[model samples]
Target: MLNAIEMILICLVAQAALTDLALRKIPNVLILSGLLLALILHLLSGQPGAPLSQWLAGGCAGFFLFLPLYLLRGMAAGDVKLMAMVGAFVGPWQAVQIAALSAQLGGAMALWMWWRYSSKVSVGIPYGVAIALGTVGVVAWRHH
Candidate 1:
């Protein structure tokens, strides 16, 4: 059974993926809500370590991880924000794992799209799906 944090992360990423697929944009409102929820959950978790710092660091790690790609025009801002939202839930270490896994999945998706569409592949891929899958996979693996 998934905990509250896991459930919320899943719901957040699922919504992000859906919106990204349909609109090619992940709303800032969603991201902001997820971040706020993560902060509240972390505060209530009552872990020994500094929960606030962990949350901030995790968010920064996730954001910086993809900032370069965004700056390079390789990805959209929504994708970066989505990752940061995931990070806020899981923390920096898991966020890194999710980013790596998401990159692999995104690459596979890109390859498939390239092969299938050939010269007609102009639309941006909905990378939030990869991020969502990666986040869910890591959370499941950690809990299992």
Candidate 2:
């Protein structure tokens, strides 16, 4: 059985992935709503396994994990914020795992796109898809 936070995290990430893939952007509304809901859930639910400090650390870790890529113009601001919101839900260590997995998934996607596109046109990937998928993987792993 999934906890409330876990379910919300899945829904939020799924929504982000859908929006990102279709529109090529992850909306601020989704990220902010996810963060706000996570904080509220933490405050009200008294969830086990992680305290508020750990949640904050997770958010920070998630933000910093992708900050370098964003700074290098290799990623979008929405992707960074999306990961931070995911961190707020999953906590620090899991967030690290998710970020690492997300990077691998994103790289695979890039390679696939490169191979699929024989033309030399530049194409930007919506990394939120990778982040969402990675988050789902981590959450599913925790469940089993």
Clash tally, candidates in order: 0, 0
In candidate 1, stretches whose alpha carbon ends up further than 4 angstroms from where it belongs are none
lDDT of 1 by residue, 1-144 (tens): 899989999999999999999998999999999999999999899985646666888898899998999999999999999999888888899899999999999999899889999968597889999999999899889878
Task: Please give the TM-score that candidate 2 achieves against the real structure.
Answer: 0.94
Candidate 1, residue 104: Cα displacement in angstroms equals: 0.2
Q: Can you tell me which runs of candidate 2 are displaced by over 4 Å?
A: 47-51
Q: Could you give candidate 2's per-residue lDDT for residues 1-144 as a string of tens digits? A: 789999999999999999999999999999899888888888777656454675688899999999999999999999999999999988889999999999999999999989988558888898999999999998999889
- After superposition on all C-alphas, the RMSD of every candidate to the true structure, in Å, is 1.1, 1.7
